[model samples]
Target: MKSSRIGRIPIPLNNVHVNAGDPFQVTGPLGVLTLTVPSVIKIKLYQTMIKVTPVFSNQRASAIQGTVRTLISNMVAGVTVGFRKVLVLNGVGFRVSIRNNILTLSLGYSHPIIYCVNRNIKLHLISPSELEVFGVDKQLVGQTSADIKRFHPIEPYKGKGIRFINETVNLKERTKKK
Candidate 1:
C-alpha cells in the first residue's frame, strides 16, 4: 500500500530541533516538548524536515500515521511561534484578574473563585472580562481555556459566559407572562 498521504508530507523543522525516539523531543526557542510515538508508527529526522510512516500497511496503521503526522506538525508550530487562546466573560458583574499566577474570578457568584494558573501557561488579562491564554504547547493552552470556560458556560437565555474569540452563541427568548 502507498504510504499515508498526510504522513508523506514532511513536517518542516523550522527553528525547532526534533529528536526521533520512543518519545520524540522537540526543542526550540519557546521550550521543549515530548510526544510518545505509537508502536505502529515510525519517525525519521532529516536536515530541515521530519517524515512519519506506519510500520504496517493495514487500515489502523495508516490512520495512526496520519494522526501522528498532524500532531508532530502542531508540535513544531507550537515550539516555533507558540499558541494562544482568547476568552471573554459576557455577563454583568463578571470579572477576572491574575496575580502571582493565581486568578481571582468574580462571575456573579456570592464568593469569588480562586483559580491556580498553570506554570507553563501564561494568563494575560486584557480587561476585567477578557483574558488570553498563552503557551508553547498548543494542547496546554487549549485545555486551560476550556477549564476556565467550564466555570460558567454561556446560558441559552442570556448568552452570557466565557467564550472564545471566535465562538458564536445563540440566545433564546424568555417565556411570556400570561
Candidate 2:
C-alpha cells in the first residue's frame, strides 16, 4: 500500500495539548477546538508530535488519513496563532464600518448593507475601505470575508467592488461607437 505523502509527515505541537479520544480536543493558549476523528484514520501522539495513520490500507482510508491530518494541523495552528483575512473596497462611495457587533457597508448602493458579526469572529475597519477579519478558525475567517465581499463583487467594467488585499481585477474596455 502506498502511504499518503502528507499523512506520513508528523504534526508538531507548540504549547498545545491534544486529547486523543472519540471526540478529539485540542487546547491552546487562545482557545479549545473539538473534532470527531474518523474511524478510518487513527491519531497517535508521540510526546509533542502527532501522527495520523490509516486503519486500513485501502485507498479511501489513505485519503481520510491525509484529510484528518490537515484538519488537525489547521485546528492546532488556528488555536495557537489564529487566522486573519483582509478585504479592501475599491471605487467611489465605498465604505465599511463595524459598530456594536454590526458591520455597515456602503457599496454605492441605494442603501447601506448591514451584517451581524459572529461571536467567534472579530471584524475591524482599518480604513473606510479596508476591513480585517480575525478568528481562531480558518474557515470562519475566510467565510466571513467572502460573505462581505459577496455584497459587491468586482465588476469587469469599472473594477469597483470588494476584494482581498492582493486580489486584482481586470477591467474591460468601453465599447466604441462610430
Candidate 3:
C-alpha cells in the first residue's frame, strides 16, 4: 500500500464548494477552479474534512484517485492563499520597471529589454533591484522567473546578474599564470 496515497485536505472557507457526482467548484482570492471525479473514485467533503478513495482494485487507479484529490486540494489552497516569487537584481545598472503591463529591464545592457506581462500573472517592482511575481499557477510563476533570469544570468566571476533570492551562484576560481 502507498502510504502517501492516503491523506486529508482542508478546505478553506473562501475557496471550496461541494457538489454532486464528486464534482467541486472552488473560488478564492486568487481565482477559481473546478474538478470532476469518475465513478471509480469516491470523495466525501464534510464541514472541514475531505476524504478520497478509489473503488477499483488496481494500484494505478488508486494512485490516480489520490493525485486528483491532491491537485484539487492544492488548487483550493492556492486560490485562497496565493503564491509569490521574489527575484533580486545583482549588478550595476540592473534595474526593472513596470508600465502599462510591460516590464522594462536594464540589466547592464546597452538597450532596455521589455517583456509583456501575461494576463494570468501579476508582476510588481518592489524596488529597482527587487521584483515580486504572483500567480495562481505555479508553473507560470516559475517560467516567468526563468525568463527574467535568462535576460541576465548570474555570472560566476562576480556573481553579477539577476537570480532568485534563494539561489546560489558557483563562482569560478581565477587561474594563475605559470
Candidate 4:
C-alpha cells in the first residue's frame, strides 16, 4: 500500500452527491463540478461527508484513490472560491494593459506583445506593473500566468522581467574585474 495515500481530503461546506460507480457532483458557492473516479476506488458519501478508499490493497490503487479524492476536493474548492494569480512587471518601461479583451504587454522590447484572452478567463490590470488573472479552472489560470510570464521571464542578473507575485528571484552578484 502507498503510505502517502492514506491522507483524507476535507469536503467543502457545500452540497455533494455521489453515486456509486458514477461521476460525483459538487455544488459550491462559485459553481458546480463533476468528477469521475475509477472503478478500482470506492467512494462513500453521506450528509456533508465523503470518504474515498481503494478497493484493492495494491499501492497503485491506493495512490490513485488518493489522487482522485484530492482532485475532487480541489475542484470543489476552486468552484466555490475561484482561483486568482497575480503577476508583476519589473523593468524600466515594462507595463501591461488590457483593452477589448486583449492583453498588450510592453516588456521593454522593440514591439508590444499582444495576447488574446480566452472567454473563460478574466484579466484585470491592477496597475501598469501589476496584473490579476481570475478563472474557475486552476489549470487555465496557471497556464495563462505561465504564458504571460514567458514573454519576459525574470532574469537572475538584473531581475527585470515578469514574475508571479509570490515568486522570488535569486539575483546574481556582478563579477569584479581581475
Estimated TM-score for each candidate: 0.94, 0.96, 0.80, 0.86
Q: What are the lDDT scores of the predictions, listed in order?
A: 0.90, 0.90, 0.76, 0.80
Q: Model 1, 1-178: lDDT tens per residue?
A: 7777888899888878877866899999998889999999988888989999899988899988999999899889988899999999999999999999999989999999998988999999898889999998888898999999999999999888889989999888899999
Which tens-of-lDDT digit does each residue in 90-127 have in candidate 4? 99999898988799999988999999988778998889
For candidate 2, give the lDDT: 0.90
Off by over 4 Å in 3: 1-15, 18-24, 35-42
lDDT-sorted candidate list, best first? 2, 1, 4, 3
Order of all candidates by TM-score, from best down to worst?
A: 2, 1, 4, 3
Candidate number that wins on TM-score, 1 or 3: 1
Highest TM-score, which number? 2
Question: lDDT at 65 for candidate 3?
Answer: 76
Better candidate by TM-score, 1 or 4:
1
Error of 2 at 172 (Å): 1.6
- The regions of model 4 sitting more than 4 angstroms off are 2-7, 15-22
Q: Which ten residues in a row have the lowest lDDT in candidate 4?
A: 3-12
Deviation in Å, model 4, residue 113 alpha carbon: 1.2
| Off by more than 4 A, model 1 | none
